[model samples]
Target: MADLRVLIVDDDFHVARLHATWVDAVPGFAALAPVGTAALALQAAHSLRPDLVLLDTYLPDTTGLELLRTIDTDAIMLTAASDPESVRTALRRGALGYLIKPFSADDLAAALRGYARYRRVLAGTGSLDQAGLDRARRALLGGADAPSSGGPSRSRSATETAVLEALAQGPGSARALLSAAEVAAVVGVSRATAQRYLAALAEDGAVEIQLRYGSTGRPEHRYGLSA
Candidate 1:
């Protein structure tokens, strides 16, 4: 598959460049040169036909949410606007993900990974089953909740099996749990990939997650085989 082209739409040139660098670091995304105004953004969206837009809430000519309404591309609101109204509006406008400004690169990567997962889950032709549709939507949350199709009939994918195997080889104490990075190292995959699978497993009741709180940010999740 071709790398998903991303148009950076932020007024700050330096911030846009920094975000572009971060986007480029991910495996399957490419960032176009950043644009500062809604006018340039519209022109680029028309001409470039990018697969996604990393949009800032504040722009020179218009609000990012308003611009989002006019653009015909997928978008993630990367903005400083943390007001409840702004967040709710972005969701109503079909923004794939919303990241508050000052977010870490890991935060953005997680959102992008979730969006990629969403695209993959919905890519095939024909009408989707309820489980399939639910899975695709949950992918927007990075699969934190997993697919709800439970029971003995529920089967694990090859990658999920690999993640489980990695967990088995990890620290063998009753309370021991491994982070996604540790599992990724063992499985020879990116942390983001490992995280996506691990989160699903955790949510499906196939694995257990231990939330380890640190001094800052969200608590780190560690995984163990469910007993």
Candidate 2:
């Protein structure tokens, strides 16, 4: 298969180059020269005909969605603008994926892999079977087609489900995630009981626990959802 050509569009020179480098590092992807304005992006797309574009929401000349309307190939938006309107517009304008900013390189790689699969499926010769069509559809969405079997998402014993729900929705910062004591209070259980549940959940990829450090005290386990 041929390498997937990607045009990265962002206003910041440093960020654009960083993403360009990351794209080039991926096994089946190559980065085109990035552009800082929507006008340049449109021109690049017209002339270069890249397989995909990594676009930002804001451009010095126009909005990314505006540029999206003119481009013919697939696009995956990578932008800091997390507003509902922008997300909706990107989808409505035919974006293939929406990746929020501050994402890891792994996240971008996953998207690229999914896009590659989608393109491959589309290029297949024969009519697709149910499974083949399903794979193609899931690739565009960039995640598993099914809801997680673990966590608070399924039917289970009443006691177990209630505890999972609490941890799944638990909110905390990087510095201070909800501790076992806090989760215990929320779920009407003892601290030790909450800790046991959290540990189990973490092992199952339902949630994660990290230590929060402070200048004056020892680090403590803080709980957050794996997502």
Candidate 3:
């Protein structure tokens, strides 16, 4: 498929243009004409049908989160707003990626890479089963750490705590990648049990998985502390 088209929405035309430039520079993305208002953004999205949007949260006509819910495409929110509520709301409103203001080009590229991965998973052959769908969303949003309707979590269990501790300490070999099996042995649990904890740890941003390529066959999955 061709590169995903992007719409840049920010009140400052310069910033919007800059975002468009950034989007265009990414290998798998193309930017549409920058729009400086929410009304125009809505209109553009409806008419142009871009694959993704680069939304500015501080729109003069309306709040970005409010616009986000009504838009058809996924978004990577751009804003100077540093409040926790804004982050929560943006993610809740179907934002696949969130980029705080004054970010580098590299940062935007990383977010785009994530969104690309998310799309690739969805576009793959056959259909995604429930767990596969969940994993794909996780790939998009970075993790499942968003608070539930009940509000933020208060605590972690013993096993969860131990898993976090192990992940904190690097797996000790640059050549060898950590796995649930290793973590399970360390925690004195089964690999399946270790995976459950590891999944939580990954959601909480404590661990990151890397693919290990061998001389032949399929690549293996390995774990490590998040950078």
lDDT of 2: 0.76
Root-mean-square deviation of Cα positions for candidate 2 versus the true structure, in angstroms? 13.3
Let me know the TM-score candidate 1 reaches against the reference structure: 0.66
Model 3, runs deviating above 4 Å: 141-227
Which one wins by lDDT: 1 or 3?
A: 1
Rank by TM-score, highest first: 1, 2, 3
Give the TM-score of each candidate. 0.66, 0.61, 0.60
The candidate scoring highest on TM-score is 1
- Cα lDDT tens digits for candidate 1, 1-227: 56688999999999999898787655457789899999999999999999999999999789999998999899999999999999999999999889998999778877876787787787788899998888888878867333323432477667877888888878766446998789889899888678767655654677886667789754566789899
Better of 1 and 2 by lDDT: 1
- The CA lDDT at 216 in model 3 is 83
Q: What C-alpha lDDT do the candidate models reach, one value each?
A: 0.81, 0.76, 0.73
Model 3 accuracy (lDDT, Cα): 0.73
* Lowest-sum lDDT 10-residue window in model 3: 143-152
lDDT of 1 at 186: 88
The lDDT leader among the candidates is 1
State, as a TM-score between 0 and 1, how close model 2 is to the true structure. 0.61
Counting clashing residue pairs in each candidate, in order, gives 0, 0, 0
